[model samples]
Target: MEHRVVLVTGGSSGIGKSIGIYLKSKGFKVYGTTRRLDSHPNFTDFELLELDVRNPESIGFAIARLMEREGRLDVLINNAGIGITGPIEETPHSEILKAFDTNFNGPIHMSKAVLPHMRRQEKGLIINITSIAGYMGLPYRGFYSASKGALELVTEALRMEVKGFGVNITNLAPGDFATNIASGRYHAPILSDSPYKEPYGNTLKMMNEHVDSGKDPMLVAQMVFKIINTKNPKVHYKVGEFMQKFSLFLKKILPDKVYEKLLMNHYKL
Candidate 1:
């Protein structure tokens, strides 16, 4: 893994930044992308490139610059994403679209953009940073779940499609982490007169609290390093507390209504 060039989208902060720093410390050439390069004047852990996953031009330019600089892109970590929470009915359609564009389409486009280069070299790995919530439909976070879940499934199919080309793609679904995701999350306002006010409001409060008390982002970085060093990586990887990861196991075994009831009870709905 030494001197291998890695690109992490949304690397200016949080999990992406942590991964970049950790990899750089291990002697890998790492580059991170933020939509705005000037916003983070102090982010010197690794080179940060300007890119907005939702824009095709920005994606191409960033990928081109990295390819030119390093002459190769060894790994692509699709870690850039946004968090959205609100009653699906109450959340603006625009917000839903934005969430999907960033969380789902952006990664697909990124994978597509990098495939040619990877195929040409016949060696590359793409790690999609998804969410545990993506495994199930969570209350007030349906769209967010859908977007990540979409990426998860896409990774499954893409891995097969590109396996012969010597390219590997995988999903790393993390549980809540103490990142700035809360501040950037688009929260549907709690309308006082709305029918779902109390539940949505309570859920929103719980969501933010979970993030505030979540584990460090460095754990994810460690996993990223491990996956890179492995000769054969899996299609999906989860990093989080036991219960958070266990919940996915439960979802697989629990009946439909039982799981729904459990979620409702957990959120106190």
Candidate 2:
């Protein structure tokens, strides 16, 4: 009858927020982290921790505080991330670094911080929020896709590495969910006036439109809950509509050139 202790990063809004609330409703002792404390009002009935996933010190401090208070860490959802839209060539070095820091390195830092506690307990779950873009690359979202791809790889390696310790790892690769993740997309400074602007202009617009009309965020939260509770959890959970199915199909059935053509046509590239 013990309640599970769950920590969700970037839980102030979007999929993370929904997931946090859903977990809370399931009787979990949920702790949500956000970089902006002002936005904490959106998340009620859950402990709020101020954390910037990009900062190792912030991650370490938050984990330490949680461990000190609760004495055990049952689940860690690395959900903090940022998206960048536009051509890869037009993305500034600094912006790319920022994307990687948040999307890729952040989870790595959090996982490292939580490992000791989970290792000690010999039982825990780590759910990493990846994207469908991780499986199938999208136009004007190269950097974002790359970051998620890195996360997918990390999730795989960690899954195997932690199995010996009885710690489970799951990568939640949700397709276009109705999250504000699209609105949260950052444009690189170089992309604003770069030569590649004209070429990728329409593609960017289409990308935004697709994201703006994405699936419900709650679907992702439900899937996450399922993954956590399942006896034999999948390493990767793909959700959403055409994107999820298409991504998996391309990986398994389509020829490289055929998939490339379809992707180009789909994105108007």
The prediction achieving the highest TM-score against the true structure is: 1
Candidate 1: stretches off by over 4 Å: none
Weakest 10 consecutive residues of candidate 1 by summed lDDT: 1-10
Query: What tens-digit string does per-residue lDDT give for candidate 2 at 35-121?
Result: 978865655657889999999998888888998999999999999999897667766788899999999999999999999899999
What do the candidate models score in CA lDDT, each in turn?
0.94, 0.86
Model 1: per-residue Cα lDDT over 1-269, one tens digit each: 44899999999999999999999999999999999988998877999999999998889998998888788899999999999999988999999999999999999889989999999999999999999999999999999999999999989999999999999999999999999999999999999989989999999999999999999999999999999998899989999989999988888899989989999999999
Which segments of candidate 2 are over 4 A away from where they belong? Answer: 189-195
Among these predictions, the greatest lDDT belongs to: 1
C-alpha lDDT (0 to 100) for residue 105 of candidate 2: 94
